[model samples]
Target: MLFATEVDAPGVAALERVVLDAERAGYAFVTFPDTPRRPGIEAGVRAAYLARRTTRIGLAPTLHATTTEPFHLATQLASLDHASLGRAGWVVGATTAAEDLATVGRTGAGDGEVADVVEVARRLWDSWEDDAIIRDVATGRFLDPRKVHHVDFEGSGFSVVGPLITPRPPQGQVVVIGSDELTAVLDVALDVALVRATDVAEIATRVAAARAAGAALVFADVPASFDPSLVEGLVDGVHFHGGPPPVITASPHGATLRETLGLPRPLNRFAVTS
Candidate 1:
């Protein structure tokens, strides 16, 4: 089983220290939880900043799908993947809290809104094929326009047209993660599922449901203070709330997050596979 942790440090210095420590301790990834209660640096920006500092460890930042613009969100994440050399992940969040909605001057997102946002982001990532950037100095051409296709995603609340401003990320697509509860309710596909439960029985049930919902990896979200034996063999991995345990045997460093997670690089939808 793999181990992961959350780093919610308030400042860059503190966050860097904790993240480095987690990397040393051998955790697969460190997540930054973004919420109204914990007001601080944006999660994606934090990940981008640390992308230069560390190697091997995956950086996943939480972003609310409900309020954020899908086009910009997709672009930002694609850029992060580039900055991190394909070691980026996104925790798709949906919030209906009064304060959160008020901050964006928007209404609450429906049940499937998070899924819609995820789908649109995936499409945008694929809109630019792998070889879209030809950069042929001889012909004075930077890219092949034919290789970049329009996504034309129309969701319930908003619509995105054509290709993303950013090129396709190094990983083709950044790994997508969501809470087990959220994935359970919506028909969303996730690379990883964070299962939050108080005990083994609950963890098992949630893991089963998350797998049924098409999550490739299922991890239990355990509190900072908890029994390790209760969940060791039950889930694919464990995501600590405050931090990881004191002792962890690090896994072999994989070049990218998807590589570390044993997920294959996705085929570019816009690529011509003749």
Candidate 2:
């Protein structure tokens, strides 16, 4: 069983303390809600800071795809993975309101468009082959250009071309956490399903459907005080909120969320084969 906490309780210092405590208490991951500005730091910036403060705990920050450019989002996530050594996850969603879209110079975005953004991110992540960087000092060759492929992604919401400036992350593809509406799109394309439910039965059903749909892991959004064991067989993990600072423990630490959940590290589909 794995535990999680949302780092948005009191203030920045409190969030830091909660993250450090969660790391100590053997929590699998901590999520930073992506509230634009409501008496809290930005999720990505907050996660970057927390990444430096803690080791072995996954740092997942909610990111809205509609407001942010897909290439920028991909780059940010890839950088976060590097900073966290493969412990980064993207909790992505899209904005539906026209006014909100206007703030970012975008229009006509929906839940389905979020999937396209995620796909673009994935393609960019795979742009550079794992062994693309050779660093052959003798030949003064830093990277093998042939190994880097252009994404050439064209979608209704956005379009992109060429490889990402950053190389593929250590995790290849960072874990993706999405709302239940993304279940169909995320299935076979993403990693984790972060679903909200009002009751245990609802949680069980939703989680089961997500699993059946192709999610490797499913986390039910619940109170931080909720018992992880209650959803033991129902879901893979429990995402909680409103908890005190976690304390240190003796259990083994997982470098990635997959490790924390006993799931095998996924192989990169774009990886070169000998």
Candidate 2: where are CA atoms >4 Å away?
Answer: 37-40, 184-188, 242-251, 272-274
| Candidate 1 structure, TM-score to reference | 0.95
Report residue 248 deviation for candidate 1 (angstroms): 1.3
For model 1, residues 101-202, the per-residue Cα lDDT tens digits are 778887566667888999999999999998889989999999999888888888878889969988999998999988987777777789999988777898
For residue 20, model 2's alpha carbon misses the true position, in angstroms, by: 0.2
Candidate 2, 1-274: lDDT as tens digits:
5566677756778888778777878888888876433355678888888777778888999888778888988999999999988888888765566776776776667545677888889889889888899999999999998888888988765679968999998888888887765765533345778777748888888887888877788888776566666777787667776665334343466776556666676555566442
Q: What stretches of model 1 exceed 4 Å from their correct place?
A: 36-38, 243-245, 272-274
Backbone clash tally for model 1? 0
Highest-TM-score candidate: 1
